[model samples]
Target: MREDTTVSALDSLYLANSIFEGKLLQAAAKYPFTVSNFFKSFDDEPLGITTSADGVLIIYWWDTLTGGTQHAYSCVAQYKTAHGIKSVSPASPNKYSCSYSKIYSLKSKDKIYYLAVYDEILSYHDRCQGIQIFLIDKDDLMPAKLIKTQTGLHSKIDYLYNDNSMRDQNWENELTYHEKTQTLTIPVALENGNLTDNYITYKFNGEYFIKLKSK
Candidate 1:
């Protein structure tokens, strides 16, 4: 995460989302797509860059907005090279999301994954307490098929919501990575006050790092 932001962390995200609104619009226009009959998908919008030994793949996130608010986030991938555009990943909405796409590579740099985890800020009371994980594939930059998680991973966003105004940073990963094991460990609090040192772990599968267990 970029810690240099003088303002709050999520505030940095919120600011980024707002600041790049124009770029988003332009990206959406560049690759027009429709998600469903009811929604216009922006899965083609390039919001991230993937650096892999295989090659550079541009990442895209389509924000489905309704009534001036984001309803869904769709991910897409584009293959790039000096000669020309080599290929394009599926226009389909993969798990592409992240305030900023942080790429984690395995033994090979080209073989990697993108991570996006965010706390549901608009949630009212505890109804919206949890961090949403959207993991994207290295090849497609689309949502990986193996893993996705929502709750039991983040400390709840409670009454202090209004007090903080910008929200809490509990959603951030308190991490431990095992090189040989290829595991990412994140310590989070339970929602119902079950445990304070609850740890959720993800093991890198062949394609993605899926949630292994929590305790």
Candidate 2:
């Protein structure tokens, strides 16, 4: 890459970081939360910290256990830059009972933050089930309307109902907003289909309304 191209990419990243930081800071002023724990899990030091985007500081932690299962959680919190924390609000507990990998994304736009999660479940029968995109607005924390949910089996897995079955379920439990198209896309896949690369995309306006959908 040329020097100018590199510089431009750096500038874009810096601007995005700045916007997220500003959101976190603002959230800190209102709620004021802090990290209360950090411990070693499965040989990895899992640290908890307060992060912000558009002045909203979000508290989160990630840990890996013996088996390949990774546990993680995040909640909106009040940030106090001086004291490091002010307080934290209680978030509704959510539990997923499946062997799967998860990813999260936070998108800041139009003065509101969007949250999304993607989960890929690998069944014992060699089947795969995916939840494309699930989303919630920062202000309400209520899940937005269901964009799309899909499930199927991978090709290598012959019998779809061999002792274990890949039931079509809501797996994409993560979300993030797209700045260019003002859309939210959550990564997802099917268990029986040859969909190694599939995603749920939603287009919305500033008023927090869904207008379009695509895979």
lDDT of 1 by residue, 153-174 (tens): 3211111122132255454434
Which candidate wins on TM-score? Answer: 2
Q: What is the C-alpha RMSD of each candidate to the true structure, in Å?
A: 13.8, 17.5
lDDT of 1 at 59: 45
Locate the minimum summed-lDDT window of 10 residues in model 1.
Answer: 154-163
Query: Mind giving the per-residue lDDT tens digits that candidate 2 earns over 38-85?
Result: 223413543334333333334433222211333323333443333344
User: Could you tell me the lDDT of residue 210 within candidate 1?
Assistant: 66
